[model samples]
Target: MAKPQVRYVCQSCGSIQSKWMGQCPDCQGWNTLEQEASQAATPFANKHNLRGGGRRIELASLSSEIEPAPRRPTGMTEFDRVLGGGLVPGCAVLIGGDPGIGKSTILLQAAARIADNGGSVVYISGEEAVDQVRLRADRLGVAQSPVQLGAGTAVRDILTTLESQPAPTLLVIDSIQTLYSDQLEAAPGTVSQVRAASHELIRYAKTSGASLVLVGHVTKDGQIAGPRVLEHMVDTVLYFEGERSHAFRILRAVKNRFGGTDEIGVFEMQEKGLAEVTNPSALFLTDRDRPVAGSVVFAGVEGTRPVLVEMQALVVRVPSGATPRRAVVGWDSSRLSMVLAVLEARCGLAFSGHEVYLNVAGGLRIGEPAADMAVAAALVSALLDRPMPNDLVAYGEIALSGEIRPVSQSAARLKEAAKLGFTRAFVPPRGNSGREIATVEFPTLAALVDHLTDGL
Candidate 1:
C-alpha cells in the first residue's frame, strides 16, 4: 500500500504548504489555501522533466551538433515579424486575451498554415466540440490541411495522443484552464490543475521537439487567468490586448526567453479573420484634412519594432475650486502627471486648476520614454489652442530639472520618422544634432517653449 501524502496549495500563487494556512504567504491573499488529495502530493509527479539532467558528461566529449532552426510561418507577415522571425521548436507560447477577441480564430488560422506547409498540427479544443470547430472553420473559410482536431478536455488523454504521434507536430491547447489530469484529484481549472497541465505540456514539447501554443484566458483585471507559476513555466507569453469596440488588436510580448519582450504585433480584426497590418504607423495616424489642436504624433520603439503613434490631450478650465482632475485613458496616468509637472515647471505653463485628459490613439499603452515629448507637445498644443504641424514628429524624455533627456534608439527613431515622410522632428539636443530631419534641438523644455513661441 502507498503512503498517504498531504499538501496545501495556494489558489492564487501556487505556493505549496505542508499544512493549511489562512493566507497565501507569497501573495498575501486571504483564504487562498486549499487542500489537495493525498495522491497529488508526489514531489516528482507535478514537476516538468526536461532534457540534460542527471547526466555526468565531460564538455570535451560532447560534439557540436547545432541544427538550423526551422520556423513555422503563420501566413501573416506582421505576426511572423513580431515573433522574432518564427515559432521555434520545443517552445511553449502562452497567448491570453478577452472573450470574443478572436483568440481561437488566430490560432486555428496558424494551424491551417502549418498544415499547408506540410507539417502535421493538432488542435485540442476544450471549450467546443469537434463539430463546432469544423463549423466555425467553414464559416471563416479557412483551408483544411493536415490538421487533426480533438474535442476532449482531459489532459492525460491529450498527452497520450501527443506521445503516440511522431515528431514534427505543432500542438495547440485552446486553453490551459480546461485541462484536467487524472493523476490529481483536484477539479479542472483549479490552481493545481492548471499548474500540473502546463508542466506536462511543456515537458511534452521539449522531449518531442514540437512547438506548443496554449491559449489562456484573462481575468476582468486583464491579467492572465492562472497561477503566476504558469507564466514562469512557459517559454514565451503573449497578450492580445485591444478594446472590444475597436477593430484593431495588438499582440504584445510580455515574456520571451528566445526573443525580445518589447516586440508587438498589430492585427486588424476582419470578417474573414485577423489581417496583419504591414504599416502600423499609417494605420494608427489619422488622415486629417488640417492640423487639429490636441493632436501630436509620437515616434516610439516597441522592442525592435519602430512605431509612430498619435497622442491627444485636452486641457479645460476647472468650473469649481475643487482642484481639477487629471484623467488619462490608455496612456499611463503617472507618466502623464510627471510630464504635466515638467511642462508647468520648465515651460512656465500654469496647469494647476485645469482638468487634463490625455489619450493614446489605437487603444495602445505607451511605456517607452520616447512618448514623453509627444505627450507634452500635445498638451501644449491643446493649452495654446493650436495644433502641431502634420509633417512633424517628436520624441524625448523630460527630466525634472527641465532638461530634454536623450531617449534610446534615437537614430533608429529618426530613420523611421523620415521613412514615414515626416519633414520635421523635435528631439533631445544632445541626441538630435547629427540627425537628418529639420531638427529643433532643445536643451530644456523651456528652450522648446521659447523655440515654438518665437515662431508663433
Candidate 2:
C-alpha cells in the first residue's frame, strides 16, 4: 500500500499546494491554506487505467421528445416562486445565509409542509440535537408534522441509514459544512470533507429520485463557505438576505439550471416563522400622504416582478476646508459617486463642498441601473430643498454622457406604478407610455435638472 501524502489546500479557492503558504496563489486570500492528506500515487495506478473497463453511455438525438419534470409544491408561494415553480424530483438546491438569518427555519417549514401533504420527508441535522430541532419545530408551530428527523454528522452512517429505508420524497440536510466523511482524514468544514459530503448527498438524490435541499454556511463576505465547486454541483443556489434590524427577508436565486436566475421571493420573519409576502411592493413602499424633499418613489423590477421602492437622499453643505463625507445604504457607493459626477459635470451642479447621504428605504437593496434616475432625483430634491410629486415614480438608466437610457420592462414598471395610484412617471425617451398614467420623457440628465429647477 502506498503511504498517504500530505497536501495543503486553500480553503478560499480550493487550490492544492505541496506546502503551506501565507497567501493563496490563485485567490490571493491570506492565511487560508489548510493541511490535508491524500493517497500517494503508485506506478501501476497510472499505467493500468487506459480506457478499457468503462461502459459506454447511450446517446440521444437533440430533437428527441420528452415530458416536463413533475413538481411537488411545498405549500409556500414565495419559496416556490424563488424555486422557479415547485421542487422537481431529484433536484438539489443549496441555500446559504448568515448566522441567525432563518435558513434552517425556512427549510424546516418547507419540510413540514411537504410531509403534511402526504410526501415522505427526512430531515437530518448535524448542527443541532434532535431535541433542539424539535423545540424549534414546536416554536414554529410544526411539531405535529410527520417529518422524520435525525441528528448525525457522519456521512457514511447517514447514507447507510438512508439506503436501508424506502427513498423519501424530500431530503433536507440542515447544513453541509458539519458533515464529515469517514473516508477522509480532514475534519468537517474543511475543503475536502465539504466536497466529498456534498458529492455523496447529491448522488443519493439523483439515484433515489429525491428532492434535496442543503443548507450552507456563509463566510463574512457573504459567499457560501466551502469550495466554490459546491455551488456548481447543485442545481440551484439561493441566498437568504436581509438586515437583522428589519423583518423582511429576501431569498434570491443566483444560479438555477431549471429556472430563471435572479428571481426573488419575499418573506417576513414573524413569531410563527417566515410568511410569504404576496404583494411585496406594498411592504417596500412608505406612506406618501405628503411629498418631502429628498424622497422619491422608484419603479424597479426584480426578476419578472415589478416593484416600487423609496429612495431618500440628504445633502448638507460643510464649512469651508472641511472634507465632505459620502455615505450610502442598500445601494452601491461607487454608483452614487458616478451619479454625483454626472450631476456636477453635465448639469452644472456643485457638490464638492457638501456631504451626501443616500438610502433605499425598507431595508431593500437596489442593484439595477434603472435606479440611477430616481437616485439623481432624490439628490437634486435634497440639494435644492424641493419636493418631488408624491404621485410620480421614476425609472431610467443614466449614461456617463448624461443621456437618459431606457431600461427593460418599462411597461411593467409603469403598470405597477399605475396600479399603486401613481399618476405620473419620469421615464427615458421612447419609454413606455401607459394609458393609465402620464409619462414625462427626459432625454438627458440636464433636461431633468432643468425641469426640477424650473419650479424652484
Candidate 3:
C-alpha cells in the first residue's frame, strides 16, 4: 500500500497545494493553508477500466405533472416567510451569520414551536452543552416544549443515534463547523471535515424525509466559513444580517430551489428571543414631524414585499487643499461614487470640494438599482440645503446618459408609499404608478435636479 500523501489546502479558497506557503496563491490569504492528508492512488486503481457498470438515471419529460411539495409551517410567521411559506420535508437548509447574530436563537425558537405543535424535533448542538440549551429555552419561556436535545460533535455517532429511532420532522444541527467525521484525519471546521459532515447530514435528511437546518458560522468577510460547495448542496441558503448596535435583524434568502430568491423576513431581537416584525416598513422608516434636508423617503421592494425606508445624505463643503471624504452606510459605496459622478457630469451639480455621507436609516441595506434616484435626490437635497416634501417618495433607475429609466413594479412601490400616507412620488416617465398618489415624472437626471432646486 502506498503511504498517504500530504497536501496543504487553502481554507479561504479551498485550493490544494503541494506544500505550505506563507500566503495562498489562489486567494492571497495569509496563513490560511492547512496541512491535510490525501490517500495516494495505487497502480491497479489508476489502470482500472473506464467501462461503465452503473445503472442509468431515468429522465422525466418537461410536460409531466407534479404536485407541489408539502410544507409544515413553524409557528413563527417571519421564519416561515423566509422559507418560502414553510419548511418542506426532505429540504436541506443552510443558515449562516456572524457570531451572536441570533442564528441559534431563531432556530431554537422554531424547533420549540414545531415540538409544541406535536411535530417531532431534534436539536443537536455541537458547540453548546445540553444544559446551556436548556437554560436558554427557559429564558425564552420554552422550557416546557418537548424538544429532544443532544450535544455531540461526532457525525457518525449522531447519525447512528438518529437512525435507531423514527425520523424526526425537523432536524437541526447547530454550527456545522464543529462536527467532525472519524473517517477523515483532518480536524473539525477544516475544509474536508465540514464537507464530509454536511454531506452526511444532508444525505440523511434526503433519505429519511426529514427537514434539515444547518447553522453555519461566517468569516470576517461575512461569508459562510467552510467549503463553498456546502451552500450548493443545500436546498435553501439564508443569511441572518444585522448590525450589533441595532435591534433589527434581517433574514434574507440568497438562494432557494423551492421558492424565489431575495425574499426577506424581519425580526427584532428582544430580551426573551427574536420577535417577528410584521410591519417592517415601520421599523426602517424614521419619524419625521417636519421636512428635513438630506432626508428622503425611498419606496423600495424587498422580494415581493414593498418596503419604505428613509435615505439620508450629508454634504459638507471642504476647505482648499483638503481631500473630500465620501462615507456610506448600509448602501454600496461604489454606487454612491457613480451617482455622484453622474450628478456632476450630467446634472451640472458639483461635489468636488465637499464631503459626502449617505446612510440608509435603521441599518437595512438597500441593493436594488431602483434606489439610485432616491440617493441622488438625497444628495442634491443635502447640498442645496432644501428639504423635500415630508410625504414624497422617490424610486427609479439612473442611466449613464442622464436619462431616468423606469423600474419594475412601479405600481407596487406607489401603492406601498400611499399606504404610508405618502401623497406624491418622484418616478421615471412612462411608468404606471397607481392613482392612489400623485406622481411627478422626470425624463432626465437634470429634470430631477431642476425639480429639487426650482420646483420644490
Q: How much lDDT does candidate 3 score? A: 0.94
lDDT of 1 by residue, 73-104 (tens): 76677667666777888989999999998889
Residue pairs of candidate 3 with colliding backbone atoms: none
Model 1: worst 10 consecutive residues (lDDT sum): 40-49
Model 2 deviation from native, Cα RMSD in Å: 10.3
TM-score winner between 2 and 3, please give it. Answer: 3
Per-residue lDDT of model 3, residues 179-279, tens digit only: 99999999999999999999999999999999999999999999999999999999999999999999999999999999889999999999999999999
Between prediction 1 and prediction 3, the one with superior TM-score is: 3
So what's the TM-score on candidate 2? 0.89
Model 3: how far residue 386 lies from native, Å: 0.4
TM-score of 3: 0.89
**What is the model-wide C-alpha lDDT for candidate 1?**
0.84
lDDT of 2 at 8: 97
Q: lDDT of each prediction vs. the true structure?
A: 0.84, 0.94, 0.94
Worst 10 residues of 3 by lDDT: 45-54
TM, every model: 0.84, 0.89, 0.89
